[model samples]
Target chain A: MQKTWNNKAWFLVLPVLLLVAFSAVIPLMTVVNYSVQDTFGNNEFFWNGTDWFTEILHSDRFWDALVRNLSFSVIILAIEIPLGIVIALNMPKKGVGVSVCLVLMALPLLIPWNVVGTIWQVFGRVDIGLLGHTLEALGINYNYTQDPFAAWITVIVMDVWHWTSLVVLLCYAGLVSIPDAYYQAAKIDGASRWSVFRYIQLPKMKRVLLIAVLLRFMDSFMIYTEPFVVTGGGPGNSTTFLSIDLVKMAVGQFDLGPAAAMSIIYFLIILLLSWVFYTVMTQSDAEA
Target chain B: MARIDLDHIRHAYGAKPTRESDYALKEVHHSWNDGGAYALLGPSGCGKTTLLNIISGLLHPSEGRILFNGKDVTNLSTQERNIAQVFQFPVIYDTMTVYDNLAFPLRNRHVPEAEVNRRVNEILDMTGLSDMARRRARGLTADQKQKISLGRGLVRNDVNAILFDEPLTVIDPHMKWVLRSQLKRLHRQFGFTMVYVTHDQTEALTFADKVVVMYDGQIVQIGTPAELFERPSHTFVGYFIGSPGMNFMEARVDGTSATVGSQSIALAYAPAVGGAQKIELGIRPEFVRLQREGLPVRIGKVEDIGRQRIVRAEFEGKPLAVVVPEGMDIPADPRVQFDTSAINIYADSWRVGSEG
Candidate 1:
């Protein structure tokens, strides 16, 4: 058999390549360009190699924000993953209640992120908000504006309330795709409820859970909108995540070189963590 | 093992079942014998799986009771009933090893560890999965996974019955034969009250001692393979049981004589069909003998199927099939004689008895 080698087929990918260069590559290259340079007023630039990266790495503000970001991601994943599985397991498998429950679950995910932030901000005000008023009437000291602990709690709660639905919806999709035969077999096997979840439901939901964990980790790590809108990194930088701090540096003080360096480090950390998560999960999946 | 008595069992999927059409399984009142192998044979949507589920207690019938060993177990769950079922597709714990998969049912019931090991090893040997016992079930082929499903059903020693719903549908052709024979051997050795459900006639006829034929949500006949072949109780049974099926023709009958088309043939005995609007005479292709002088048929195409020849012919503008021995010659003036003793008379699709 004779094979035809046509290099013309490479032309088919030209449009996508150009679109990706314009959308992602060019912007990323600009950040890379800024990270290794020094800039003065009037758009004058000088070649400065790795000075901003080293300075950003040594700064306590950057390290503190990174630690806070990692902790928040860990907390969100730990709470949301198990909570999502439990809620999905308890959801109705059939009947009119299925649609109703699905719609309710999707409601939290449909609201814009900033709107969610605003809603929580108003709801958690110690002086005028419903939750804060109730807590105060019950004789609790809860004011997010002045208390660092209260600010952290308010931000964490707001993030959880806004994002837990994504995990729930993903786990629900995994749960529903499992055929009824598995449940029937489990019942006939004399399995207890926990055994059914452990062996059947959990195993069936493994892939979706991996996806949920990865998505929640990345999204919560880079989170700035909802928390900033609600707390504004208040109470002495108690809830200032990496992105919030980066924006404060770049947009607030116009330190483009250091901010670009910090942003690149943040992106690399997320990429590394996500890759580790994906590989570890898929490896266990294969070995199992 | 226990005798399963379905006492006037009926099921309707809809909440308000006002008419007979609403019922998925019409009334089934029959007792399957203890330690007997039975097969429920039917086409798709014929209520076979519904009846199987009812027997396994996965479903609660809309009407009537199910009894195991003369004890009413209508309200019992599948676990309480102590029945095991293998579904059409293999249901395995993907994270477990083959050995662990087989041991799952026993461990779920809190069986002794020693007993679990014994039963799991025994099933592994029986299912030819001993070599793969340490391998994860997720990596195995479909047939091996299905074997795990069957092994799970067979691991328990005290189950009331083991129900199989088309368990061999996922296996390859050669493996299907091997697994079927293995199942038959297992049935012989254990004598469990097995009720295998399938749409294939060969599987039902070969695997079961008594084949229960169903059509349109009703059991038309329940008999041994030979009995079903020799005497089909309904026209549907006659059509569904055999290859090329039984040949049916409109007939007018009086005493021991049946007039099919223009020729009148003598019957073995009188069939009491009193004022029935429709009458049909049915004979299997194997029983339609080609003779020198009989009702004339225009021979169309003769099919030589290795061991036998099926002569396709037309009689009175109706197609007919006659099975002839290999190398038998079709005479110049072709004729067919329906074996009198093998003929069945049907009135309104129901076979009429000689006593009637």
Candidate 2:
């Protein structure tokens, strides 16, 4: 017997495809159009052919921002991953204490990214902010507005405070999902506390940790709102991440053609990095 | 091999259990012989697992001492106890190969590489996992993972005891039988003190040399399968250890006869009762003889279970199950007779001494 096939199923997904086309694909095409062309005011466009791409590829500004983004992501990950695991380890397994700890950790995650930046901006001020005032009173000048080191400290601390909760939550979920059986097995094996963490807890948490790493990396790499609101990519562009640079080109300078090309480059970089992370992590999962 | 002694152990989760009834495990004092296979069998919320955890040093007893080979290990951790536990679910390192998972404990103790390999290989052979040694643990079936868990527990020769808490629950039925037999073989081969915890009566009966039946918060009975079946120390044991559990009929005992709702049944021995109020007759379905002439019973349903037909009937208004031969005919008026020699009398859930 021959089977009848219906092609109308494709129509069911048409709305979703249209939505994606409008929101993402159209915008991406516009960026691509701008990338290969030169535009002047009064809606005039000239085919510049690969000139913007070549310029962006050779530009030191793009490289510096990329390096800064990579370093920031690496540092944030290095600090957050282990810290999150440790926090998760120390958390109460069961009872009201678990709920209390969860709520407390989630408090920062609930605050919008821009709000987090605003809070940190006010809190790290030299004159009125408690932390800055206390540091000044201790005979230490901690002004994030003017000093590069202070600005870096402020940005790093702000990032940690805002995003560490995500890592914590993921690690916590992994920890909670581990049946008491594993711990029991570990105990019976005469496993030392460190060995238990290494052989049992660490391996079990690998999947979640990978997610936390990818999320933190993407967020830190594309960091614009917090640093822009706090330092305005300033104290001599010390805190100017890739997203900040991209925004400066696209919005501040308003050189639409070059900025659009830069935006495409930025988008490609994120897509490539995220793809790499996903592939590596998922491949390891498959191997395991 | 070491003897484990639980001395007056009592535990309560909350602070200061003031009353005698406040304890979760009420003063369990028992001794298990070296290299003995014991099963702690009970329903959930029966404190069987709690006692096992306490014995494993996962939980600290609120009161009393646990001695492993005469050394007090009540305050010690599970690592100090030198015990290997296989939990209900398989707890293997999913990222590691089966060989690596088995080799983990040995390597952690810094055992020689060749020796670790030899031991792991031997365990893999024992667990029927030799073919899948190089395969990662994550992709294997559930039962296979459980086998890895068992192998991990059994790999360490220096451990004093191996504890299993419902390790076969996730296993398929056929696999469960094979594993149980394998475990029995392992126990005999290794001569390790093994304490198995399960709610399944068949598993406990087949696996353990001595079964510890728990009820409420106390150890109801601890004996061999034969002893548990023939002479259950408590009513809970009589009810728990059998498939169609022992039927209890409320009766008035007088000399060598028990009157069950005006029907007098002869007993081999008289019930010892001076002030005992609630006397009950306990008898298993296997012991209840279905004869043509005896106390009248209304047969309600018959279940033909391959080997035998279980007759579900009402004897003097109380439900009773009688196991007869597979091809036996159910008479129009079936009469059941209690095997006098096998009958057990109980007073308030505890077995009373028989007066001959």
Candidate 3:
């Protein structure tokens, strides 16, 4: 029997397309308009073609922030992936303990982003917070607000605590899916624990780890909430990342043309990096 | 090739088993000769896989020792045991090429590069995967992936014993047959001590020289294929080993005669019944002869299975199956005669000694 072709499915997606166009496209067009033109009060506007883009492309602030974002993403990925895998390996595979461990790891992830920042802000205080108080009692001058190194450390640690669970979860799923037979086979082959992890567990976790890296990179690069709340891009702007600076330019100084151009450039950078990650990781699978 | 001795081995997953009933594997003690192919045959939840794991050093027996070539290995890990295993489903590195997968174990042991390549190629050729060696294992069909798993197990000749845990369960029917025959050939050529585990009777019967039939976590019988078929030590063996299983009829033994219901049939041997416990007569469908003149039976239905016919009927109100040769006319009046010497008597679900 010949099947009837249904065109009604397109109708289901029309609303989503309209919603995206209204919410995303119109704002993007407004940004594009701002990017190419300068506006004063009373709706007076002057055409400024490619000037803001050229200025952003040549700015040291933009370059420094881009470098900072790249480095942070790389460092976070380097620390999180291996740490996640190790923790996942040590986790109980079944029974009551599994649920407890899962809940514990998931606790940090469930907290709101703003709450996470607030909690860290208080917790890292030199006088009131437990961590800072303990470090002071130990005679260490640990103040995140005043020290660039402290700010960087706190940000990295916070990112690790909040996001490492994602990697652990993905790795755990990969680990659990492995049949007992592979371990048996590994045992029969007299494989060392390291070899088993390297050959079997690591390879099996490739696809999940790829996802973890991409997600962590994207989030770390675009991080604005926690660090902004904690540092306020302060202490001589030492902790000022791209998002903080973007907000500073767009909202603090109200530099519309330059900020819009900067925002577009930032979006393009993230898009390009995410696309690279996806392409490189999936290329081998596609080729095979 | 090495002789493996299991000395009073027992295992439990948790704490010490307080009773014989508490153990998953209840005191298995057997020694398999070098180069002899054996199969651990049992249904799921019967602890066959547990026993295999213990033998492979994946699990330590709570009681007794495992000896490989008269040396104790009870404290060894699976790696130290030098045993290879193939699992039920394929356990291959999906991202690696088939060649790399087969070569991984060899490289781990620091085998020379040229030698690794030579042996890998030989194994790939043997497994009929030479054409797909360079291809990644992820895209291969299930059967092909399983073949890679099998090849990984068989690649290293230095291992003491190769254990298979229902490895062919996921394989296609035709591939199962081909792989079984190929494995049999590999075992013969290399003289490896191979122990295959499967719940399927056909695979167990066809692949191994000796079949160890287990039930409820105990090894009920270990014998050659013929011995298991012709003379089963336990009622479970008789029931589990054959298709259509062994026909059992509740019986009462008196001197040289056995009575089924109200009909008394003469027995070749007399079994002593000490108590009012139940007694049964066990016979295969193949041995129960259908005739025109004998004990009357109510015919139920006939199943024509190509070369033979299975006459499903009731004898003396007890279900009985009789295998009749094809092309033989079904008599309007159907009767069955038990081959006297082929009869087995059981007491309380166990075979009893009866003088023949």
- Evaluated on the second chain alone, the candidates' TM-scores are 0.98, 0.96, 0.96
All candidates: TM-score of chain A:
0.97, 0.96, 0.94
Give a tens-digit lDDT track for model 1, residues A1-288: 999999999899999999999999999999999999998878899999999999999999999999998988898888889888889988999999999999999999999989999999999987889999999999999999889889888888887888888988999999999999999999989889988888998998999999999999999999999888988887789889999999999999999999999989999999999999999999999889
The single-chain TM-score for chain B of candidate 2 is 0.96
lDDT per residue for candidate 2 within A1-288, as digits (tens), equals 998888998999999999999999999999999989997778889999989988988999989988988888898889888888899999999989999999999999999989989998989888899888889899997999999899988989888988888899999999898888787777676678897888788888888998898888888888889999999998887889988988888888987777888888888888999999999998977876
Model 1 residue B157 CA deviation (Å) reads: 1.3
When sorted by DockQ, best at the front, the candidate numbers are 1, 2, 3
Which candidate number has the best DockQ?
Answer: 1
For model 3, report the TM-score of its A chain.
Answer: 0.94
For each candidate in the order shown, give its overall lDDT on alpha carbons: 0.92, 0.88, 0.89
Candidate 1 structure lDDT: 0.92
Tens digits of per-residue lDDT for model 3, A158-229: 989999998999899999988877787777766778888987898788889999989999999999998888
Segments in model 2 whose C-alpha atoms lie over 4 Å from true places? A1-11, A127-129, A133-142, B19-21
- The residue pairs in collision within model 3 are A190-B79
lDDT of 3 by residue, B1-356 (tens): 68999999989887967887888988789998899999999889899999999998888888899999999999988878888888888888766899999998888788999999999999988889999999988889898999998998888888899989999988989888998999999989999999999999999999999999999988999998888887777889989988778899999899889999988888887875567488888998989989898899999999999999998999988889889899999889988888888888888877777655
TM-score of chain B of 1: 0.98
